[model samples]
Target: MNASTALLAAAEGGIIGDGRTGANLALGAGALGMAIGWLALARAGGGISTGNVRTGGMAAIAVGTVCTVLAVLHLATASGGPGTGNGLVGAIVAVPLGLGAVLLGRRALTRCRRADRPADRMTV
Candidate 1:
């Protein structure tokens, strides 16, 4: 259910003879399953963290996060070996998307905050 539990389950039931965790852990489809599901609800909550968020940025973040999840799934299930998976492809997509989302979202938030401040008025 939780990440630690998913990880323990993965250790017991993951790729044979892995004896390790890396890309599989990073991608973490099993662990991410819960997180990805919760992300949508979190976005809708509209707290300080989620309110007035940029749409484009949010979209990128969601897609990037899922790409990472798929990447992990691919790595975990890879036949060749742990590091032999094509999940790097997912990482390639996710990293930039995630970074761009952060930058753009921050810029939008700054603009929103500035707009909320009162402006000076002049009198004759």
Candidate 2:
């Protein structure tokens, strides 16, 4: 299936178990993106030197985007209310988590760019 079709299926919880599955997936993606963004930020700040900050930042951005999209799609497709076992609450919660991850990733990317730039030289 195409990417959008797959994402729709995931949002509908058709790929696995019950209604909560999609929300759970979104939550996991958001958390992972946040972690990667944190690590990339640390690396940009010279706190570690094991991995490429740029790559980590890019990954964080991608994951965060996915999380947000999944959560939104779930929310759109979910039936009933928060207490109806439709995972409405979980999807709502995932939205902020995903947004936070995106912000963190963006910040890390900015820091990485600044760190990579060379010092300005005097012009004659």
Q: How does each model score on TM-score?
A: 0.38, 0.93
Over 1-124, each residue of candidate 1 has an lDDT whose tens digit, in order, gives 7975554445333533342333444434323333333343344344336433345335435544543544444345444542555344443343444344444444544444555557764222
True-structure Cα RMSD, model 1: 9.4
| Candidate 2 segments exceeding 4 Å error | 121-124
Best by lDDT: 2
Candidate 1 backbone collisions, by pair = none
Candidate 1 TM-score, true structure as reference: 0.38
| Tens-digit lDDT string for candidate 2 (6-115) | 99999879999899999999989989988998898899899998998888988888999999999999999999999988788999998988888888888988888776
How does residue 47 of candidate 1 score in lDDT? 30
Instruction: Go through the candidates in order and give each one's C-alpha lDDT.
Output: 0.43, 0.89
